[model samples]
Target chain A: MDFAPLLGKANFWAYFFIMLTGLYGMAVKRNLVKKIIGLGIFQTAIMLFYVSIGSKEGATIPILTAADAAGRGGIDAAAYINPLPHVLMLTAIVVSVATLGVALALTLRLWRRYGTLEEDEILARLRGDPGGEACTPRS
Target chain B: MIQEINAAILLLLMVCAVAALQVRDLMGAAILFGAYSFLMCLQWVSLGAVDVGFTEATIGAGVSSALFFAAIFRTTRRTKD
Candidate 1:
């Protein structure tokens, strides 16, 4: 019904597509590292969405400049874009790094344990498939 | 207007994302992901989030790529699928 709002904003659709792309990659890719990359892309897409919503036309950052002090009637809150989303994204970014590190570490361990990064192969090995020989049990 | 530039950047982001996923070489994928992060940083800068852009450039592009490279070196570089 309300096509106007949805059609007018291009950024939202762009971010939406990016998020979808990340999800598709995460789900379809068999390699663990590729899955991790997809997760990173998904995180960035969400961050972009949040930051985009907090933006305002003709507004500067949240920090007040000296020009604002010289202006009349104190400082107008509307002059600065919303800071909360960006602040939250900062933490999200750090968390993404931590998550990536831990995920990669786990991936490394998995690779060492199974000698393969493919999920299906790992699953097959875990299932004690005839070809994989029930994992080599490396140290 | 900044809108056109933003739109173009978003398109580039989509292309980069596809390329990153399509690439068979894991090392290449990691590099492409780094480029995607850098472009995302530019998008943030154009969107008036300079601090967020800086952090993305440093953490997303720089440190993340480094960690990815380290992992790739330790693991297999080519994807069977």
Candidate 2:
């Protein structure tokens, strides 16, 4: 019924869609590398949302120039955008990169040992299905 | 903050995310992901987050893409099914 409010927040919804796309890729894709790509997308969609909320219209970044500091009695806090979200997102980005690197390394190791990056094939070989070599199921 | 640029970047981001997932070549998808990250940094700068823009540019676009390329080169390139 009320489309105005919905349209006003188009940016948030767009990011939500991106997150959904990432989730779909992670959940449905059989390839380990593809899943890592999805994870990267998912992390960024959220970080983008955080950075946006910290910004303010008609306000500058949190840093203050010397001229503004020298001329004013103190300064209006409202003139600068919020810095907390940006700081938090910075930590988030670093952690996500570390996570991605470790994940890819694990994927590399999996590829080396199993000889395939596809999840199902890897599992099948682990279960000793093809060529009857690795696991040797005994029950 | 530039509202128009943010909107355009958001649209491009969504497209890139989907395309990166759908592409058959993992290396090509990694480059698309780099483009997505760079566009995201632009959005952050236009939103007045300069520090964030720089961080994303270096880490997301540069470092993460390099990681992906390394992973892809070490593993298979084409996907089946």
Candidate 3:
């Protein structure tokens, strides 16, 4: 069997692997921070997928020259990479950072209230039974 | 040749994901997740998506990791269960 197409499409596989790793981490990790990190990884993988699809072999940066903008020179699509994905990625980056900041702030508040980062500990504190005489209230 | 390289990178990503999931330590998992982002950035670069790679490296590996670590600090780093 000819594996030519598969062999040629290296970017696809790389992105796929990265995506899987991130998702698995998010799914299996118990810690809140770890899960957030996993989410970051997952986002990154998506970004990679978007970017890869916008590129082509031997393409240059997508910056437009004054000559092209003025319409004095013909545009050469072959010479430049697609600019749309890049623009989108910039916006995504900003959003991701903002989200991360908010998530961190929330985590800090959670820590203060629960006195622990562990999921089980937080649940215990929420239940008002922190594994002690206070929790049991012996008669 | 290109496919082989991608396959290798993909394999690395899989390993990182497995490690992130298997690790008992939360901090370690966060770090692995960061590594996963880094690998993804490289993948983007290979695809000629420089802008995407730049953002991934900055927000994914840098800002996100910092946030996760901060969150970890706020929460318990150790697991009771």
* Winning model by DockQ: 1
Evaluated at residue A10, the lDDT of candidate 2 is 59
lDDT of 1 by residue, B46-73 (tens): 8788889999999999999999999999
TM-score (chain B) for candidate 3 is: 0.89
Worst 10 residues of 1 chain A by lDDT: A130-139
What does candidate 3's lDDT look like per residue over A1-139, in tens digits? 9877776676667568767766875675545666666676677667767777788767777766666556764567778888898789878778877877886787778878776665555666778877733432222
Better of 2 and 3 by DockQ: 2
- The DockQ scores of all candidates, in the order shown, are 0.73, 0.71, 0.53
- Rank candidates, lDDT, best first: 1, 2, 3
lDDT of 1 at A13: 87
Write candidate 2's Cα lDDT for B36-69 as tens digits.
9999898788778899889999999999999999
lDDT, candidate 3, residue B34? 82
Task: State candidate 2's DockQ.
Answer: 0.71
| Alpha-carbon lDDT of model 2 | 0.85
Top candidate, metric TM-score: 1
TM-score on alpha carbons, each prediction: 0.90, 0.88, 0.76
**On residues A1-139, what C-alpha lDDT tens digit does candidate 2 reach at each position?**
9765654465688779988988998988778888998999999989878876777778887885565645773456889889899999999999989999999999999988998887777877878788634532422
Question: What is residue A46's positional error in candidate 3, in angstroms?
Answer: 1.9
Chain B TM-score, all predictions listed: 0.94, 0.92, 0.89
Recovered native contacts, candidate 3: 0.68
What lDDT does candidate 2 reach at residue A92?
Answer: 94
